[model samples]
Target: MKAISLFSGGGGMDFAARSLGIDVLFANDVIPETELTFASSFPETDFHLEDIRQISKFPSVDLVTGGYPCQSFSLGGNRNPANDPRTFLFKEFARVVDTVKPKYFVAENVSGLKSIQDGNWLKLQLDTYNEIAGVGYNIATAVVNARDYGVPQRRKRVIIVGVRKDLGVYYHFPKPTHAKPDIAAKKGLLPYASHGEAIRHLPLDVPGEYYERPHDPEGNFSWYYMSRNRKASWLEPSYTIVANFRHTTLHPASPTMKLLWSNLADGWKQKWEFSSEYEHLLHDPTLPVLEKPRRLSWREAALIQTFPEGYEPAGKLEKKFEQIGNAVPPMLMRAILQQIVSGEGLLQFPSEHEQYLTVGKQLSLLSEEQDIEPIES
Candidate 1:
């Protein structure tokens, strides 16, 4: 099947689609650097460096895959996706769907889209989607956790799959492969991927100031692990990968912050309080055991996002992290594709990949010219 990639940042979704043997007929992103990023990695696709509104037409394809600008729908901002110009960009997505009339369309966005103002915006979004598509389209929506789909990180995204009603098919999301973090396996679910297991091979930096770790400019490694005020374990999945470049998930090396909960004498006023403070350990009665804390490097962040090592991002250091963080975990995307595509017309999904899924340390997806030694186990 062929696809048109919209808002294709660093070609994360595109890469996943290609892995399934889906040809991306056209790729577009507002960020010009993304064109360079996608072209360098996927020379086959026709990369377009322009806004979605500027592109009057796009080649017809079987699938339309991309997550439109998510900042408006995200929780950190003003939470005005309903009225924000960026949120309306989904209409552009619908525009292509209407014109190309693809058999299936997959749209992804931040989970916050489900409810910002009592789910009023979500209702508007679905209504707009159905209106633009006219009739004979069945849209299925779900808020899925990436970790549940086998991703090492605990990222949750709202995915929508629309099938042409003529196909006589109702989309159903596939069951998760991984269970909740630190939870025992129950029936079919497996254990969540932990930070230790995800980047255990990458040698830890020797107490660094900067987040960037030098890896011979050809290899990947862990760099910085800035302290986060949270009590977590290497046994649990990494926190959600946020698009904010300024903030990063804490590493597993550090001790989980200690949480203190107590009830005060005042019944109605200040009745309860809780704290996850590291300061409490500074002057404790005895020495406190703690691992040195650090911030996740760009490579480590990308690895958590489930991108292959060879799938490098271009542009500035901050942009690299932003692209990776904002991207749809390819492994999560692959699982969605398997369910949507089924056995229709000779599928080549990760279910039976000839080589292997984008796991471990090697960049097996790359050609010999860009190949490097796999990270030691």
Candidate 2:
């Protein structure tokens, strides 16, 4: 199968597609740093450094895959649920699908997209792409966690799959290949990959020939960031890695922040303090004080995201973190694409036409309920 990749940050999806023998004809992203990283990694692909709305033509292929920008709908960002221009970018995705008419299309976004504006945004997105090129598509959406797919981060994302109606196939998402240790034996699955296991062998203090050096923010933590525990145990998966380097998960070697107390009157406002176990070292002039708590290095973040070994992201430190955080974990993408191509999780629909009609009706009612309308582009 051939594919065209949009919003292709650091080629994570492209990497997975290639691993599965899917020929990616073209990849595009507006960020110059992403272009540098993607081109270096996928020199054979036609990498376009331009906005998606500016590009009017796309190569025809069997599949189209992209994890479009999700900031406006993400819980991490300002949720302008009603009229954020970025919110309408999915229409461009639909436009491409309509133009190329691929056999299948996969769109991914933050899990927060479902609850934005009480799901009106998701409904409008689905209704927009429900029927393209007149043949229509049987779309299925599911929320998947990266840990379940062997990635050492507990990141959750919404995966949307669409099969052209003429194919008459119901796409079933891939089941979890891994589970928490306690339930793994019962479910006959492998144990979840641990944060320690992912980066235990890498150099911690100094930069090696292949991996970058570890570093943390230089100043005090923000009130918003300090409100919750940022440290994960070595035995568990790391927290979600955000695009901003300053907000990435803390290294597990450091003690978890101590929660002093919570005030019930002010929305349960809490106070957090750094562990004082190492404070004695600060007082001793002869002994070396411990370095401040550091975040996962750029290479460490990529490792936890399951990027291939030795895959170096191009550009400065900030850009590297952004690309890695924004990327779809290759392992997660591979699991889904494998199921789509192999029909391993294929399901049979009793009445395909009726199902399609029902989906359309639900989307319509959802639009009416929320009184939220999609912006015209």
lDDT of 2 by residue, 1-377 (tens): 99999999988898889999999998889888987887778888888899898999888899999999899988879898556777788988999999899999899998877677777777788888875768888887766788888888898887778888888887777767787776788767888888766887777674431222336442456545677567776767899877888787776655457777878588856677777454323434343222566667888888888898898888887888889999999988999899877877556662232133455354333222121111111
Q: What is the C-alpha local distance difference test score of each model?
A: 0.67, 0.76
**Candidate 2 wrongly placed segments (more than 4 Å):** 206-220, 260-271, 276-292, 350-357, 360-377
lDDT of 1 by residue, 119-162 (tens): 55656656666665445466666667787777888777777777
What overall lDDT, based on C-alpha atoms, would model 1 receive against the true structure? 0.67
Candidate that would win on TM-score: 2
- Candidate 1's displacement at residue 282, Å, is 21
Residue 237 of model 1 has an lDDT of 75
